[model samples]
Target: MHLLAFNGSPRLRGNTWTLLNQLKRGAEEAGATTEEVILNKQHIKPCQACESCKKTLVCRIKDDMAPLYGSILSADMIVIGTPVYFWSMSAQMKAFVDRWYALDLDPIRPRLAGKRFGLVVCYADSATETASGVVYAFKSAAAYFDMRFYEPLLVTAGDRNDAAGNPQALQAAFALGQEIAKP
Candidate 1:
């Protein structure tokens, strides 16, 4: 099986990236062919609200997100990792998630249905508030697409690489990865 993970953290080697890699490592150990995409490094434009995807059944903007369509469609599971921003997921993650609108078209919905999903969110303060928004977003999307929602990992006070010091969060992320990899 193939598992795709999107690291939406702007920091290349911070807490979010650290947890993302840990989770991916567990997925790899679980025998899944996994790939992690660092969203900040890619040039993915925000949705323009042009709604051109309705008739064409594809995003009109040409960028890195185009290639991701195929990977997202074919993957058995997906993991989203991001640092909290404004008590929610990072702006980068929001854009990427919103772009999934292309796949949510009525005719194309099947491409995303029944897949599994996991969330990894890190924050500096009030983990509850930061994680709640992100968790709700993912859960709503999973429900809309009939996908399985795996347990989420929230790292509190992890503005830097504080999450790496939290053994519990690391183990939880790894376990979630293993769980989603199971048939």
Candidate 2:
């Protein structure tokens, strides 16, 4: 199986990326092909509600997102990793999610149906409430694509690099990856 993980954190080596790396390691060990896309480094534009995708089943915007559509559709599983910002996803992550509207338009509805989906989130606050909103956001997006949602793995950290060298979060991320890769 192939898995594509999208890192929505702007920080290159931030908590979110660290956890996602652990997940990728586990998937690789499981003999599954895995790839990571750093959204912040890509030139993806937010949907403009142009309704072009409804007609052509493709977005009209000539940007990085055009290439991602094939990868998203071809993946057996997809993992989205983001850092919580003010009890919600970061703006960079939100922009990536908004582009999914192209895949939701007519003739492209359920483009990712039946694919497995996983969520990984990092929050500055230790309280679960701080992660609740982001979790809902992932759930809603998964539902829209008719994807099967897997249990989300969340890590609470007091510092930006809290995920680094953290064995527990790393283990959880690896386990989540294994589960997603399993039949």
Candidate 3:
């Protein structure tokens, strides 16, 4: 199986990234090949909302997001990791997610119908408000695209590497990875 992970946090070494790595290790152990895309570092522009793509059957923007369509189609599962900023996901994550609108219209969308998607969210707050919006949005998007949604792994971490010390969080991430990778 092929699993593609997107690190949606701008901080490369933060808790979001930490959990993603742990999750990736579990998937690797389960015999899945994986690839990671650091969304913050990619030059993906926000969706223009132009109707042209609907006719063209592809995103017309000639930016970094051009090649990701193939990656999404090739992967059996897709994992997105992000830090809760304000009451929702980071801007980088939002931008990447927004660009997925065209994927909904792609001619190859049917071939990717069952692509599994999971979210890994790290937040500083104990309250649900910190990450619930992100959870709902990703879930809703998966539904719209007909992708199977895995249980999200939400970690309440206040520090950069808190996920490393939180055994429960790490274990959940690892299990999530394995769950998606296994037949």
Candidate 4:
């Protein structure tokens, strides 16, 4: 099985990346080939809502996102990792999520059907508000694509990089990965 994880945190070694790496490690140990893409470093354009994909089943922007479409569709599991910003996901993550609109064309809409989706969220505070938006976003995405909604892996106190090293957080992340990798 193949798993694709998109890390939307701008900091390469930030808390979000650390948690995502934990998930990746578990998946790799389970014999699943995994790739983690750092979305902030990629040059992906926001969707223009031109409605062209409705007929062509493809996006017109022509950027890094095009290549990801195929990989995303083929992957058995997909994970979105991002840090909470203003009580929601980062702008980079939002751009990528919006681009999924391109997959709305084919008769079997949302090429992600049957795939398992996992959400990894990092937040600065313990307040549930920070995670609420991202959780909702993941749910909506899963619903739209008819994909299985795996339980989210959330790391609070994410304001600091060392937060990811917390024993409890790491344990939770490992457990989440194991659950997602289960048959």
lDDT of 3 by residue, 83-120 (tens): 99887888988888898878777576686678889899
Assess candidate 3 and give its lDDT: 0.88
Query: What would the per-residue lDDT of candidate 4 be over residues 105-162, giving only the tens digit for each residue?
Result: 6663656788988998988787766798899989897988899998898778655576
**Residue 182 displacement (Å), model 3:** 0.9
> Candidate 3, clashing residue pairs?
none
* Residue 121 CA displacement from its true place in model 2, Å: 0.3
The residue pairs that clash in candidate 1, if any, are: none
Ranking 3 against 4 by TM-score, winner: 3
> Candidate 2 lDDT, tens digit per residue, 60-158?
999999899889988999999999988999888888888887888655666688999999999878787888999998998888789999989989875
- Residue-wise lDDT of candidate 1 within 137-176, one digit each (tens)? 8999998998888878888855576877888888878887
User: Model 1 off-target regions past 4 Å?
Assistant: none
**Shift of residue 44 alpha carbon in model 1, Å:** 1.1
Q: TM per model?
A: 0.95, 0.95, 0.96, 0.95
Model 3: how far residue 169 lies from native, Å: 1.0
RMSD of each: 1.2, 1.3, 1.2, 1.3
